[model samples]
Target chain A: MIAYRPREVIIEAESWKDPATAGILRNLPGIPRRTVADAGRISASRDTLILARYRGKFLKQCQGSGAEMCCNYFTASYAWNCHFECTYCVLQSYLSGSAIVICTNIEDFLEEIGRTLGRNPDRFFRIGTGELADSLALDPITGYSRRVVPFFASLPNGILELKTKSDQVANLEGLGHGGRTVVSWSMNSRRIRRSEEGGSSTLEERLAAADRCRRWGYRLGFHFDPIVHYDGWEEEYRDVVRQIFSVVDPGDVAWISLGALRFTPHLRERLIERHPGSRLPWGEFVPGHHGKLRYFRLVREEIYRKMNAWISDCAPGVEVYLCMESRLVWERSLGVAVRDAGHLSDRLDAAATGGA
Target chain B: MNITDMPIRDIDTANEECRISGELEAPALVRSLRDIGQLNPVVLLERGGRRIIVCGFRRIHAARTLGRESVPARVLGPADFSPLHPLEFALRDNLAFRPLEPLERARALDKLEEAGLLPETIVRVYLPLLGLPPRADILESQLLVARARPGLHHCLAGGILTQQSVEALARMPPESQDRFALLMERIRLSASLQRQVLGLLRDLAAGDGASWGAPLDGEEVGAILDDPSLSPAAKGEGLHEALYRRRHPRLTRARARFRERERALGLPGAIRLAAHPYFETADIRVEFSAPDAARFRFLAGELERAARGADLETLFEVDE
Candidate 1:
């Protein structure tokens, strides 16, 4: 994939004191640069990169709508959007003229994580930075992984996950992660990886990166999220599952998550208006909880059931969970009954904290 | 504004400098002028030694229809349009009595551009004054709606067609637009169903690689609408269902299979069983209404027997 280089960089004046700003300027040498008193006062496009000090809560609860069994996941949004224009991305609806904003206050974000862990020593938090933007897509330019990785290594209560689809693990090499950071990839079938996710890394590049991280002594994760179904989806996805287990040892993996394609009716309209040629969001959609559209429950179950069987066929006793599914689907497909959010959270916390 | 008696023959009716009205055929105004005469003065603009009707295209047409050679008129110089643009002047005059129709607003905006106002100024200043969101897309769609075929005028004005639907209908090939207008004339769809019908037709057409109106030309769809035994409402419903079934054959087949299984159970007429919403879930909904205790006991017994029946097990298999 071609690398993304911003045409212009607009930095907020308040971020001048932050060290990340200096690193960003040193990285993008000779690029056009302009400093504004407030990034929010100016309008920027996707071509422009705005660096501001995000004053909002850097650590927020994973907006997994409470209508379903949530995985007690927390999201830290150091950035606002991604570079790849996936056809089914929920951020497409959040298309404000304010382009991709990167918060330069990295120290403040790390301190917030530290304070939360210090406040609740008994609780194990599985915090991720990949909710709004890919965690490592901009790592080469931003060099955020070098700072965030070793910080989590010192904190014994929480584990950090930097999920991405790009094959940019060069920056992650030789970081003192101390087995506290889990580098995960958003996995998909080969056809979808080629057609829908147009600008990300290839299937080969992603698997090769996962193996590289696995050999580096970091726990790996694979999320077959938004697993699109088509005529030969079963065969293709089965091959993808087989390929993942072949490269890495099961013990080196953290967890595998499965989520079917889902969106809201509003996002469906926006997807059509923005990307008219993509038929990914149009299908047999039944209104799930919270007014979000999802695949027919039976279709979702069929997918999860087949996927779980395929994964179990390769490696037994691996921890696999559904991302935003109901309790009924969990029981029917994975044979794991989730009573509520806490039930699923405890199960995932064990996996993240290296328990049974 | 000063009123005067001006000869209608000298009025430059051909120069529609500010003709914001969509239709000039005013039957009620003509009838009123025939009975009680003109109550309002037609506003005219003086330009190049010619008089142009700025806000009274319909009034002038009505007076002409009544065979009145001269009529009461308010003649103004071009500078008199002032603080407000000529299009705004005409729009406010029309707005004083009733809301401007969709085509009128579109035409008025078009004329505002012609009246030396920037597109940005029209969007920022005039759009909100006209009760529209200050959006370029809304303006573009309204302009497309204004240029729709004359066959779609009554439907557009009668609220049968929304701005998006009009835009959709207008963007079709001229022949397809004619076919859809003819189809719309025969069957009336509800507000909720019109959007679904348009979408289903577009999807079916795209999937089949045919014209946008190709499905309406089919014999089966035509026969459903032309059925003499069906009421208009039933025709609309039948057309929607037929389009939905064709567009989603897998879902239709699954529902038909479920219906077949439901019929074979031989449950009482009062009891009803339905699959989960869109068959997305494993749970089913069963509801029965009973008036008396005896009737309730009978329904309970019937439900239990049917629940244990052999065909009932097959109903749970909702997959294709």
Candidate 2:
């Protein structure tokens, strides 16, 4: 994938005091930079990069935290937008303005995270930065992965997962991550990647990047979330599973998450306007109790059962979990009764620690 | 601004650069003029050696229809209206009296752009003033609505099309827009049904700009539309059902099978068994309304009888 080059950069006047801000700017050598008193008010386009100080808590509960059977995962949003223009992306409707906003106060974010982990030494927290943006898509310019990998390396009670669909893994090498960071990718069939997920790395490129992370002594993860249900999907998805097993060791894979394609009605309207050609939202969709449009219950059960079986065939006894699915679905598909959010979290935490 | 009795002939009514409304003839205004006379003065701009209307196109049209040579009006010359376009004056004049319709709003926005206002300014400053959100996409859609075919304008004037449907209508080719307008006239669609039919049409296309054929294309639909025995409302419903069937053939077929199986069970009239929405789940719902305890007991016995029968298994089985 081509590296992101912002047409323009807007910096919050107060953000210049942080050293990470200068480092980020140094990477974007001659881009036009404008300093504003308030970066929040400036309307941003996709080509404009806004460097602002994140005033709110840098760490937040994942948006899917409200699910009945959540993984009890958390999100640390050092950035607020993405560079990829995936047609089914929720951010197109969730976020305003087209600009990719990056929080420059990384040091403050790390300080608060360290304190939060220190307070809960006995609990395991699985945090990621991919909820709002592709975790490593902007890593080349921001070098955020380099700063984040080592920070989690020193901690014992937490694991950081960098989920991405980009191949920007150069900065991740030669870092003392200490086996704490799990660099993952959002995998889909090659057809969906080419038609729906614009600018995202190809499946081959993503698995190759995952292999590189494995060789770097860091753990790896793969998420099959938002798996589209279509004709000939079984063969393509099964092939993807086989390719993933060929590239990296399942022992080093911390967790593999499976979720069916879903979105809100509001996001569907945005898709109609922004990506008019996309037919991903057209299906036998029913509104879930949580306000997201999902495939039929039986349809979801079939997808999860097949995907779980395929993954198990290649790498049996690996950590496989669901993201924001219902307890009934888990029971019917995975055949594991996950009682609630806390129970599921415990299961994932054990997986994160390699069956500790 | 100056008020005067200018000749109707002196004003260039043929030109429409400053007009903010699409209404051409106002019979009601003509009646009002005949009954009580003009209550307010029309606004006009003196430009290019003739007077151009800034506001009150309907009022002027009514006066002309009533055979009046002139009417009382407010005329703004070059010095009086500066730092503002004539379209704003027309917009303010109408907005002060009443809200602009969807077509008028579109025209006002198009005129504002034609008057040299930047798109950003229009989105930020004018959209809210016109009671719309400051979104460029909204602006673009509105512009499409404003410039849509004349037949669509007639449909829009009838006040049946929703905002989504209006945009969809505008995006179609001119011939399609006219046929869609005619079909809409033959049927009265509720807001929800309108979206469903149009959404199905939109989804049928594998990509954008692909033709959905015609709304009255097939022989079955054409017969339904042409059938004199069917009322307009029934025609609308028939069109909706046909489109829904096309959009979800598998689901519709499965539903027919479920209904057939349900009828074969021969439960009492008081009891009803229904499948889940979209037949998404294997669980079937049993509903029975009872006014008294005795009725409830009888219904319960009937329900148990049905459950013990083997046909209950078929009711629960979904056609995958």
Candidate 3:
């Protein structure tokens, strides 16, 4: 695991007064701390941490472009940015500031989730905490999962997916998740993990952790998202798929998602500026719906077709879906298309609930 | 610090020291000279017992055009001036008045480096003063354009060649740059087309392991360029299409296969079958225009029938 040491911690005056903030501060004993009147005053830097209260709705729908097929998944805004620097990370463009903002008002966040789940008891809600941040990269420091996992376990129809690229699952062990919380890893080929996913866990470490999660009675998920197209990608990805089945049983895996490398046009310039000498932006791209740049249709279809074939060959019974893809792409790649977001939600719910 | 009126004939107008070119007379400045007289005095340096013009070449020419026997001048001793001092004065004075053309900017940069100024110092201090980016790459690109063949420099000054296009051309051999510049000038290619052609040439050269001129000398390229009946635009379009085919042979075959499959489908002219670019996508888009409900219903029925045809799958089949 990559050790994360913030240069300094800037706490909001109100947040510093919270008891939870006091406990979090005690975890990082030697880090310098200063109290700020508001989180806005603290400039975000990669090495700085800002503990502030989150005032917005904690549960938000994933802002998928309506033009594409959406999985109808929701996200909980527990944190604002990630510490790991993936070369094509959208956070580099989405977040104006760099400071890792961890909302210290856990009570308020959990209360909102409880109220939301209570209001929709009959609705199957699949919410993830890794949209804006790595769900578990900083969990060891904050131990927020201990609070979130149990609350989700009590929900009648909601499932919490703690997606991460780190092996910080020891805290998650022994928690009474009741098989409601899913531990997912944002995985890539070993070659990609070493070169592109900087400061993230190795493929072996992540698989080992997945095995641990399986043993702990939690469902498992894997995301092959932002899959880069490079030379010899077929062999590399085939090796990764082979390794995944060898490490864990196919029956334990809930679902796997495939998404190609795509980004907004605004992120193009930022990628070049932030990661000079990066070949990620050199591929041929066309302007897609919602202003995102996507690989040529043929290129994306070929990749998906190959990946789906390889994964199905290994784990024939496991569910594989496309994330934020068009209906045509879904039909061409997976041989089936959910009617809409609601239908997609139903399919995923079945998979997560072991009904698939 | 002597200010006196010097006869226009006595001033060395043919001095090889001056780097500024093009029309020396500006109508506004000439109008000012004709109306209010010379507002600023021209600087001169006494060299070889003759006064060489240091700055204000335009003002002197305007004064001469206005039938003035003499113009206000400031004479400085040669002892205080170095060889580059006059060029420096000319550059700074012109920069204060207006933005310099690309060639003029290139010449100023060249003179600065020749005068013992480091490229780093030029990029930091002088580039911004000239309204250019303070980057070493920009400095180097400008220097390359400045040092290119005279025809290429003329094209740069004429705004026929963009900085990006010139930079790309600069990477080629001098002979190739000259040939491409001539071709571009003949075809009157827009800045965007210039870039595309240069990119195609570079890719073709790299793929073929030949010189840049080899692609230009191809039979298809020569035929397109020599087609006298075709308009320049038509020739340009034809050349780009041909070069694109050469550069992406696989994509060309895929496109040809798609066209053939689309043709075999025998859909109405109003109905268009389009595939994702490079066949990188399996999605085929069918578009048609319907003027009324009946037509719309008919088109929908036709599309439904076409979807059931076996040839529809061929449209999505690509080599990848």
In terms of TM-score, the best-performing candidate is 1
Candidate that would win on lDDT? 2
Which one wins by lDDT: 1 or 2?
2
lDDT of each: 0.83, 0.84, 0.82
Worst 10 residues of 1 chain B by lDDT: B275-284
Which pairs clash in model 3? A44-A99, A297-B280, A297-B281, A298-B279, A298-B280, A298-B281, A299-B280
Q: Distance (Å) between predicted and true CA of A50, model 1? A: 2.6
Q: How would the docking of model 2 be graded?
A: acceptable
Worst 10 residues of 2 chain A by lDDT: A281-290
Interface RMSD of every predicted model, in angstroms: 2.8, 3.2, 4.8
Candidate 3, superposed: residue stretches over 4 Å from native:
A273-277, B1-3, B7-55, B59-153, B163-188, B191-254, B265-320
DockQ, 0 to 1 scale, candidate 3: 0.23
lDDT of 3 by residue, A178-259 (tens): 8789899998988878877889999999999999999998889999998887679899998998999999888888899998
Instruction: Arrange candidates by TM-score, descending.
Output: 1, 2, 3
Q: Check candidate 2 and list the clashing pairs.
A: none
Identify the runs in model 2 with alpha carbons over 4 angstroms from their true place.
A7-10, A25-35, A46-48, A174-179, B1-143, B160-164, B207-209, B214-223, B226-228, B249-261, B273-276, B279-285, B313-319
